[model samples]
Target: MPRIKSPALLVAESGADREGHGLRRSMGLFQLICFGVGAIVGTGIFVGLSDSVAQAGPAVVVSFVLAAITCVFTAFAFAELGGAIPVSGSSYSFAYAGLGETTAFLVGWCLLLEYGVSVSAVAVGWSQYVNELLDSLLGVQLPAALSASPGDGGAVNLPAVLVIAMAAALLVRGVRESARATAAMAVLKLAILVAFCAIGLSAFRDGNLMPFAPAGIAGIGAGTTAAFFSYIGFDAITTAGEEARNPRRDIPVAILVCIGVVTVLYCAVALAAIGAIGGDAVGGQPAALSYVVDEVTGSGVGGGIVAFGAVVAIASVVLAVMYGQSRILMSMSRDGLIPGVFEKVSPRTATPVAGTLIIAVVFAVPAAFSSLDAVVNLCTIGTLAVMAAVNVAVIALRRREPELPRTFRVPLYPVLPLLGVGCCLYLMYETGWTTWLQFAAFLAAGLLVYLGYGRRRSRLARVTPDADATDAVPQPV
Candidate 1:
């Protein structure tokens, strides 16, 4: 039989290994919630509203609801597993404890696309908001050649590269500092968004909401696919299992709270955007909310405020998600499935300094030159697949380790997890076929890496090629 990490071992290794390196346990419930909000509520609400609106019209609000529903199911599963098997690596760790090495590797692969590629895409969108803010407040804008990526008809997205660099520097300083930065920015962005919603709803026109769901069921499905991207960061809360002060309780509570908070905010913003300007006006825009604010107030000042908020919001995502990605790599490296440099925590910073810098440089190239659309779909697809694996891990663990202690359990046992899997698959199908092809390519690449390098180097591989729960390469707790 293939090796599967026991839940007991997963818990036992929650502190530092004999080597004296481990993630600092500094995050409280508030910081965990801040990380969740910071990871989410960024590029999606600030920039993606236009694409979703074009697909579902005023029904984009419905799209947000449906997407949130799907996330709720998966979030339940994540809360259950995170509490029971609290560890870094989130879904990848869950899979290792429940499904075995190959599955865990694949989940980690999906996460690479989810976090790594996503940072690049979000950074690209951040450049657009930067240009918007400059034009509104400074009466000057970077030439497209500097602000836009080569794939977007420019030489390089310099702003995107700049944001990634800033985030990388902050992350290398320490997770505590990262969480503080995320929390402060999260508060600012939330307040700005709330203010925008109030201002927009005040001028709401009943006629703008007419002809909702103009594209019907198909449109809603497509729109839901895009809206799911907004919810991507909530799972990142689970990735903080090792660093969180009380992972058993805080992880589940933070997961649920984060999802609820984000859902309400998304629905409010979607409604506000649709009501303030008709779907036609909101569709195909770069910075929809800021544009609406500028239009409603009849001045650039209102837009400038919203744009400034967006600049902060998008920067928070880069910081938080980049943190999540580094932790994921650190966990993988601890398993001997990747290079050891990732797992090497800097004693001064207690962070993955070397790995974070490498990750930044690798993905920064995409942010600097690739098209935003090119990365977005691949990221969404990867996220859906990783989420589905998490749902499966929940079921697998329940059956494999019936005695495992759980601080929280999914409300309906296997039913909700099953639904979570279904929702993830349905959303994947709703996306364009090109995304499927890209995801397939990524999966193939991961398989090659695992078979060629990870399979031979894994600690489990050397432990007689069978179950070695007590002595396999344990993750960085």
Candidate 2:
């Protein structure tokens, strides 16, 4: 039997009518915004907040703002590329079009770690919250063997695995269905967060903020780096460029609006959490939100609600991240940078079913057994690297293709992109050397894939898109 090659290596003109690629152009600005929100407001807010507050005390609120500013810089660059290219691959396609094959492969490589592992990490976090909610609401709980990962002294996380599998099923069914599910969950999560803020604020103590810079400026910087992970999903808006109804106008709007919404939410949530619990308690205490709520409300109800909200929120994150990974794989497959099978679309559902399933399996395993913090750190590094690359791509495209039609352009050319690169690099450094080592290992794997298959097979390696060509119309649904 002949070995079946991966679909990611197939080179073909991508369009809605293409046999293997079935992503539809049915998403509009609202759906796009929902995607961003679903992806952005997950484990970072629910789980990572405790760590950030611990690192920076009440000053984590300021860290959230700083992280948002960093994201804004890259968001501008992404909006420009996403609008101009309007493709399914997100940063991967943009880098291919503007940079080159090697760089494109690297971008895809970075995204694999960023989205794949991030989904796993979010699923793991979801498991904890689900267990918390069950214990609180039903007076029952998943056994330790089923609720925690192996490293965390458990056999497997059944809840995490279940969530990943369910999300995969939804994605394999169709993008629209998945988006609807995500949007519903996002709404619930936001509502719960707002409720927490309103209630928690009533219990705020000014003294909780006395040692605002407990970790000092260094701690604040570290907090910002950690908090930056919370902002990763803001770029999910750009991932839907090809699906978006009006990429040029809506992608930018969605990105900006999502960032603004999430930033404000992060600040409010941090302020409330810190004010109610104090920075020391939030940082040192596990399941800080629940503890804070129990302390203030004089009942378990607040904690139960937040835990339930977290479960729902991280479910959406897992779905969105997996969705993004599959799409990127589809794009790579179409470009002949990976095996052709990954590009195969389900005739009935019109989705990259093979790719989606493959990634689902990959993510599910880790989600079942890995630690959330380890996965989160890994994702943060990959995301920061990609953001930095996008910043450079922005400058490169501007200088290289001065005449290309752009629906959205990053203002303050060079300056904003440069700042974006600088900020991402600073965060990358703050991610610590251990995470960097893991990132380096991931990058090495990507290099092996590129050298082994991607370099020789890449469509761009054979025929680069003409710099002046305007004939490549956006794919229709």
Candidate 3:
């Protein structure tokens, strides 16, 4: 049987002086905000907007609002837990402290699917835009054999492989240096979006929005499900707890602020896209924003600019997601749930070199040869389940350990968390039965790993002299 680890140990693992084994606390509030923004504004918006518009017509605006509301509730739960735990595992660490080791490992496993597949999906999107940008500017494009996935008529996606490798190399350098690169990319993408919105708003025609909500309330729900992916990356902020200068205060601030910024930006861009080209065209075009710019201006220059921005946006998202995955693995390794090598930190860079390399390779292959839709479906299913569990963990901790100091607290008590769980479950249901079956298969595999290996190796199973009484629950181990 697996045992539960105390919240104290989780917090200490992050902040304790490890004689050069700990991650560097170098990120400030600004870098953290940039990191969250970099993660949040990605292919989900650049490529997903058209899908949402197709589902809800011009009513995609309502879908964005509904999705943001759900995320806000979930974000509140994350903020409270992050402030209290201040650990790198994000939801998994919180689950370990409040639930048990079995549950924590499951969350970690789901997160692996979420982050890994998200990186792959973004990489594929990046390749498409890079091809578009090159064709627009130089009258040249990579051969289909090198630019597309196996099923998409190409043997390998060279651009996708190249971008993932670049992100991996940058992460190996150091967290601060990586953060600077992400922040710069974040600023560039934001500026491009602003320029898009300005040009698009000028072409707004009220007639385009006439058939809003064309598919009825059902369409609205479908649209919400589509737009929700844009909000998925905000949780990556909490995974940087060990690297934050003031994790308790900074993580919560960055999460909420980034969500707010991205929500407004998403709506602005969505509105512009619909207004400039109407719902029919947006629904059909994969590169909706670029197409809108070209249509409204009657010149490919505007489309070229949006294509460049898409490249920057997707690259930054891949960087942030990869960073988050490594940290989560390192946290699990520290608890003895996985191989100890993942927990190894580089003395010079204060980063997990081995874990980063493993994640890069795992995602790079899929990005090069797999279908983007399959990756997106897997990412969505895993992310929804983990987020729902996090909401439950927040409520459990509040009831079980009210004395724990929380720099940030979720307002409205149990209401927000309960609502968050419901929204997450609804989204999961909307993902269809096939996805649920896939998720079940993934969870079953995770349970096998936990029972066969994680249960026996968990550090919390042994009651050391320094271990807390609460952590020493006697079990079959």
- Which segments of model 2 are wrong by more than 4 Å? 1-12, 16-21, 464-477
TM-score winner between candidates 2 and 3: 3
Q: Give the deviation of candidate 2 from the true structure as CA RMSD.
A: 4.5
Give the alpha carbon lDDT tens digit for every residue of 292-389 in model 2. Answer: 78889998887898888888899899888888888788888877889998888887887888888898888888888877665677888889989998
Write candidate 3's Cα lDDT for 98-163 as tens digits.
777888899999998888888998899899899889977887889999999989998999899899
Off by over 4 Å in 1: 14-21, 468-477
Please estimate how well model 3 matches the true structure, expressed as its whole-model Cα lDDT: 0.87
lDDT of 1 by residue, 155-197 (tens): 9899999999999999999999999999999999999999999
RMSD of every prediction: 2.2, 4.5, 3.1
In order of listing, the candidates' clash counts read 0, 14, 0
Better of 1 and 2 by lDDT: 1
